[model samples]
Target: MKKIFIISVLSLMLAVSVFSASKKKYGKEITVKETTKISEIIANPEKFEGKRVLVKGPIVDVCKERGCWIKIGSDKEFESIRFKVEDGVIVFPLDIKGMTAAAEGIVSVKKYSVEELIKSGEEHAKKEGTTFDASTVKEPKIVLQIKGEGARVDGK
Candidate 1:
């Protein structure tokens, strides 16, 4: 009886250890730098790819169909860094445009061909009943993820 009880206790301990190990392996938490620059991210996308990144910038535009994404850059002339909401995540309000925001999420790389971008622009223009110039259209690599709350709309 004594031997059987000892064996049962040992088996239970082994099972608990295995369960804990499995949980740790599948769970991953990410931390992002607070002041990451678009130039740096573009220069080395691989370094930040799939990792949570925090960035602060003005919201240039918002898409009702595609969802909320911000363009990050010093000026509109420079190609803006685009960050889109990730899958299975709720997007922020569209009124965020023109508001300075700080967001955090997993960095993703998206590639679009010129032809594809033109088609997309045309579709968007049609939906909005506005003319879109495909000639000036740019196919940019984008980041997809969640936007965390950081600041109010007033830039305070």
Candidate 2:
């Protein structure tokens, strides 16, 4: 009777673990649509604030201080988008420099001046508390920004 009870408890625990794992997977798989135009995205960031969006564009530049933001082009002529990396997500590689990528993330449209961006980079570095140089940080022309939990690299 003792052995049988132990086995039953173990089986119940295993079943619950599997169920919880599946639930998490299903939740992650649920794709949310929150796309917007670069102009609209920047003009009225409040509309799409904190919402996951699908953005596609060429990788103009990657933040040197920390691979936090990726600059993408806008639909409008001579315009670009500046996407900030979501907190705790893996940073994309710089090798993908000129390649076009499709990324999904929450969008935040805010005005960030060059000095502000540099200061932000410095603050981010300081927060990490690592011995890193902030002088090399470069700011890009931002158009549309997307930040989320998961990002899969699409075809080159």
Top TM-score model: 1
CA lDDT scores, all candidates in order: 0.60, 0.63
Question: RMSD, each candidate, Å?
Answer: 11.6, 8.1
What local lDDT score does residue 76 receive in model 2, on the 0 to 100 scale?
A: 71
Per-model TM against the reference: 0.56, 0.51
How good is model 1 by TM-score?
A: 0.56
Worst 10 residues of 1 by lDDT: 22-31
Candidate 1 — which residues are off by over 4 angstroms?
1-33, 65-67, 74-77, 86-88, 133-156
Q: Estimate the TM-score for candidate 2.
A: 0.51
lDDT (Cα, 0-100) at 64 in candidate 1: 66
For candidate 2, write residues 1-156 as lDDT tens digits.
999999999999999999765431211232646545666666667787877777666778877655666777776768677767653354656665676655666776566676776777778768778654556655643434675444444346
lDDT of 1 at 27: 16
Model 2 Cα shift for residue 48 (angstroms): 1.8
> What is candidate 2's local distance difference test score?
0.63
After superposing candidate 2 on the true structure, give the runs of residues whose Cα lies further than 4 Å from its correct spot: 1-30, 33-35, 86-88, 109-144
Instruction: Give the local distance difference test score of model 1.
Output: 0.60
